[model samples]
Target: MKIRILTRIALLAAASAASFAHAAPAMVTEGILTGGNGMTLYTFDRDAAGSGKSACNDACAKNWPPLKARDDDIAGGDYSIVMRDDGSKQWAYKGKPLYFWVKDQQPGDKTGDGVNNAWHVVKP
Candidate 1:
C-alpha cells in the first residue's frame, strides 16, 4: 500500500510540472526573447502597442511568422495575447507582437532582425 501511494504522488508531481511548463509561451535566451522552441522572436514596428492586433498578415506573415498561442494559453504580467487577421491567437510581450523570422534556421539566430528597418529582435 505504501508503494502504491508513492507512485500516485510521483504521477501527480509529473502532471503539475507539465502544467507549469505550458504556462509561459516564451523565455529569454542569450539576452534575447525566444519562443518555446528556442527560436529567436522579433517584433514589427508597424504594430501598434496594446492595440491587440498584428499588422503583419498575408504575404507579410510569410516572412515573419507570429508566435502563435494556444487557445487555452493564459497571459499574465508583460505577456499578452493578440488576435491575428485570420482570427488566430498570438503571444505578445509588452503589447508588441512576437514573431519568428523565416530566415532563422536555428535557435539563437536573429537574421531577421532589422529587416527593411521594420523588424527588430525582442530584447528582454
Candidate 2:
C-alpha cells in the first residue's frame, strides 16, 4: 500500500510539471493587426531593427508597456529577448521590441496603432 501511494504522488507531480512546460508564452498584440487573442500579439516600428537597442523608457514605457517575457519563454524564429535598463526581459520580434498600450482597455482595441508617427503591429 505504501508503494502504491508513493507511485501515485510521483505521477501527480510529474503531471503538474508537464502542464507547466506546455503553457504558452504571454505576448502583446494589436486588435486590428491580428485575429488571435489581441493580448498575445505584438508590434514594432518600421524603422526599428533587430541589431539596434530600444529607446523607449521611463514615461514612455508607462504609456507603452513592454511585453515582458518569463524565464521559461523560449524564443523561436524572429522572437528574441531585449534586456531593459530596468533589468527586465522584454519580448522582441525580428529584433524589434514589443509593447502594449495603456489606453487599450479591451482585447480588440487598436487605440495604440499609428500613435506618435511610430508603432506597428507585431506578427507571429
lDDT of each: 0.91, 0.65
- 59-112 per-residue lDDT for model 2 (tens digits): 988988887777666666666777777878877767777777888887767677
Over the stretch 1-124, how does candidate 1's per-residue lDDT look in tens digits?
Answer: 9999999999999877766767578889989999988999999999999999999999999988889998877788899999999999999999999999999999988899889999999998
Instruction: State, as a TM-score between 0 and 1, how close model 2 is to the true structure.
Output: 0.65
Q: Candidate 2: which stretches are off by over 4 Å?
A: 1-37, 40-47
- The superposed Cα distance between candidate 2 and the true structure at residue 19, in angstroms, equals 13
Worst 10 residues of 1 by lDDT: 15-24
User: How many clashes show up per model?
Assistant: 0, 7
Query: What is candidate 1's TM-score against the reference?
Result: 0.82
Model 2 lDDT, residue 103, Cα: 81
TM-score of each: 0.82, 0.65
Q: How many angstroms is residue 62 displaced in model 1 relative to the true structure, after the best TM-score fit?
A: 1.0
- Pairs that clash in candidate 2: 28-41, 28-42, 29-41, 42-122, 43-121, 43-122, 50-95
